[model samples]
Target: MVLLPFSARNTSETNDWNGSKLKDDSKHYKLLVVGGGAGGLGAASKFARKLPRGSVGIIEPHEDHYYQPGFTLVGGGLMTLRETTRKQEKLIPSGAKWIRNEVVLFTPTQNMVTLDGGEDISYDYMVVAMGAHLRFDKIKGALEALETPGVCSNYSPFHVEKHYREVMNFQGGNAIYTYPNGPIKCAGAPQKACYITDSILRQRGVRENAHMIYATSLDKIFGVENYVKPLEEVAQEKDIDVRTRRNLIEIDTSKNSATFQLLDENGAATEDTEKIEYSLLHIGPPCSAPKALRKSPFADKTGFMDVDDGTLQSKKFPNVFGVGDCMNTPNAKTAASVSSHLKTLDRNLTFAMLGKKPYFKYDGYASCPLVVSKNRVILAEFNSKGPLETTPLNQGKPAYWAFLLKKYFMPALYWNGLIRGYWNGPATIRKFSRLVDSKKRQGVL
Candidate 1:
């Protein structure tokens, strides 16, 4: 659920929350889920129905659930933020108990989690899906500058709408977009912001007056070559300057200047630096696992939960598992990847609960829909082995149909199927589409 506030009446007062307030300020459950975003909701839904009522417990302090992928469209002015959100009470599965608080500590050794307000919870099996936190504080002046007139970001709900406003307010100058270093969700978002900005400027016929530039820490425009070639062509056609190995080190809001620390292909900073003054700046901030997860016994040194890349089960404790952005998997972090993660966890975690070794493996699948134009998208889908083509048509090119699927179809599926633990991503769709294509090619209709 999107973390936000609601009236007291709308919470425990309106309905009977199944979570108990024990005499020892403690609770227990057969299964516990920390964080109520996509992964937590999916996990709770998967197992709760099979077990008795109140068997699953989810700890999340939120009132509204957000369809996060829609944030990009919201920021681009194609959709409204309200359209991406739903009441958390309505979204949490019927059988699962929702604890409206955050976990302060995770104790995998004792199979317990300590929550704020001094409540302790013990579970037979636990799934950590707390995901990561954005740190605008990472780059000096970045967080503080978010309130400044010309600076904005799509990463936070509080600021996503500001991007459209900033772009619309532009009077013709440098419009700069940045991709941060370190791990972050939605790797393609920075460039999406760039493209959205470009779309808005071109729509306003102010493209000639503005310099659309993208500054990224990555060596390439995109990870998969199948989509990168098309993205490069889009960049060339749009006249968007795509600068690689340039990290946004500092944002000087007062002077409307951004500082970039140049890096070599080897990923080290050099003595050379470049500065650009901008009218509107959109930044993708650096991110890491939540503070509690980072400080917990389960987390790796880099602050991600240590889990087997194949099974997604905790390396230290077999009864524990991880999904989504919280795990130290090498896969690209995105909600599209969450479908694959949750699909694997729903199967493997249940087997683990039965005292069986998980035989399932998660392919590092991910998708990124690059909004190259108003009604066009370059859909990229791939796994560890490289591009895993899902659709029958060549998906490397930008198409309005892809954009329509992203803009309309995805949100509906996410709300109706994904949160209900029924959707397992487009892999099946890919296979079925391939089968249909095969029949057509063989004239077996």
Candidate 2:
């Protein structure tokens, strides 16, 4: 059961939030949530129940909400695009008002935000969960390449379905997958696609003719050292050419070719460039914080929302906070991390509402289900300090049960548990499992 703050019941609202239609352009709310993605929905649902009706307002322009983690499954032929999507209206919390518009400008100092439709809304407290924006056009000719026959991407909804189809129809040649130069939401997704493709090709007896390559701008395959060895082993076993320090810069759809800028160990581009022709290509497009947030007063030097990593509160604005990919936290930008953020942000923001400083702190917990094949996965969980496994089993090693957890269980948990704000990640389960393991070791069970 969710704990509600008894002191924050009498919240100010523009109109009766329970009404079906929005009244005016100018509005006010006790709490304003920006972006309707995982983080936004989680925060809104949690606080909507805590505050009075018409007190919480969620500003989101899109008509659909996507289960972003399901994209890899869709690309791997395990799920459909429709299964990953839901109408945005159906997900909004019952008591909260939904403002169907984009935020064009943020005036956090004045506790107000300007919408693209020329309306201004004010709030006493705000949560920035705008998330990340995919920039496929950053690569020259990328847009055109996406339209080409053999090139595809799992990042975009428009091209995600094409990925499995391309893999299915693959006759053989160079099948190249790329990871961009900077931080992406799911850092492991690019290689997930590569591994899935390798599995498919081998199953279809086309592995002999296919030259699989995993090109990445990072110096290593994965950031966490604990999971790197297993991933490297997987690549080696599949005979994949793992190329590091190579950032894709251009794509020529007509020529069926791609150009990459070679980088030094420091990740700075060198003078050298390489071009490779491909029979199939999967691009992991570069991503960053949304435009408004990037240019807002809350952003850090890296164009991501600047927040206190521990408290999830804005360093510049005390009344503001951030969650998800938009925040400049060291943790991997996955939905799992967002779920972890919800609890921390909730405790801290609720304290703020009561005119008190934040007491709860977030330990940078994150998890990435590295899908190595249709039947195997390496569940990589970690924090700022190092590897922090949840289960009693060794998560560093790929396991079939982990794959089943990722493929079958996670989506249901996300839709029914996390989105509705009940899920707070696997911390509770981890604690319980650890207790059981300790009892077993002492012969207590």
Candidate 3:
């Protein structure tokens, strides 16, 4: 198979794509990847080697891929934007075909996907890892607030840089941070941004003027208790006022106020909506899978890819698999979760191709490095069976080591090891750690 240059590929239809320079209007491959994020690119890059050259086709529009987890540190002024990205052409496996375009339609019945340019790419097997995206426009007045000076979010690349600048300029008074109403990519990130801002304010000797407030749509501070117990202590110790079950409804950037809806036990907003004044506002926008997949037979009622929680295979289509943030599984949608799921997904998908029963199991392992301060993090690691701590020590306590791991090593692993499919997750360490077994029985390692 002859390979074309990256510049020759149709990255987008509006941008100089014409059949005049093409050999064929359509193509077929053994494996097709729908997204270029951590999930699709990682799986495609790793599995491409197992197949012949040009057997894998990946649909991605962006030229630069981001290390999303590092955005938290970027917001905290601990890292730069350059540290969180890589050229897309460089990361694509040498053998795989890069279909540099966004998928406009999913036709599972026919085993094909249509690109925005009206060309259909057929595949024997496909990975539907179309990652989630921020819906800032869904929330009333959110887009304007994102463009404003004091309001910022770490959720988007365009706005994350604004966060560090906002924190530096904040003279202080009623600084508010919000966690969105539904399942977010990183549940801990919104609060992490708050803590980092608070730390910066303290370090700059302006803590006396700042009233740090954290409001979230989730009922609890965090999902798991092993870490929640200590996080509550940190909140109280730092005087960061915490309010739960409150979701952002609207923002009044002109007056520096935000409106929130109080969710009842049923998760429906009651008649009352409260508005509060603010100086600095950080927003975690509502997220969902891409629209095309949601309309296809692959997604659930909530616009998430419906897949077997254990196998990571689609319940409806045997040839289809879900990965990354697009999956309907209850696991936290972090890169760490994607790493764990891909390990199982790779094996299960391979088994399906071989017409064998899937033997490997994905136990819903996911980790969120909660950056409580600039140099400390509570590494929240867990599965369906409650807390599955990686080390022997109480992981709830914010440790400088975890922070260092998040700051320095994670990006290297993501770029070098993870996309290569060599690094699945920390599950092996969690299972084999001598400290974990001894500490559980003796209360100390």
Over 65-153, each residue of candidate 2 has an lDDT whose tens digit, in order, gives 99989999999899999999999999999899999999999987677899997888977789999999998889999998999899999
Candidate 3 weakest lDDT stretch, 10 residues = 12-21
Q: Model 2: how large is the Cα RMSD against the reference?
A: 3.4
**Candidate 3: misplaced stretches above 4 Å?**
1-26, 435-445
Find the 10 residues in a row with the least total lDDT in model 1: 7-16
TM-score of each: 0.93, 0.95, 0.92
Please state the error at residue 181 of candidate 3 in Å: 1.1
Query: Candidate 1 on 180-272: residue-level lDDT in tens?
Result: 878888888888888878888888989999998999888889877777788999999999999999999898987999999999988788988
RMSD to the hidden true structure, all candidates: 6.2, 3.4, 6.1
Q: Which scores better on TM-score, 2 or 3? A: 2
> What C-alpha lDDT do the candidate models reach, one value each?
0.84, 0.90, 0.84
Could you give candidate 3's per-residue lDDT for residues 177-295 as a string of tens digits?
Answer: 99988878888999999999889999999998999989988787887877777899889888998988899999998888999999997777887788989989999888988888888
Name the candidate, 1 or 2, with the larger lDDT value.
2
- Model 1: runs farther than 4 Å from truth? 1-26, 442-445
Which numbered prediction scores highest in TM-score against the true structure? 2
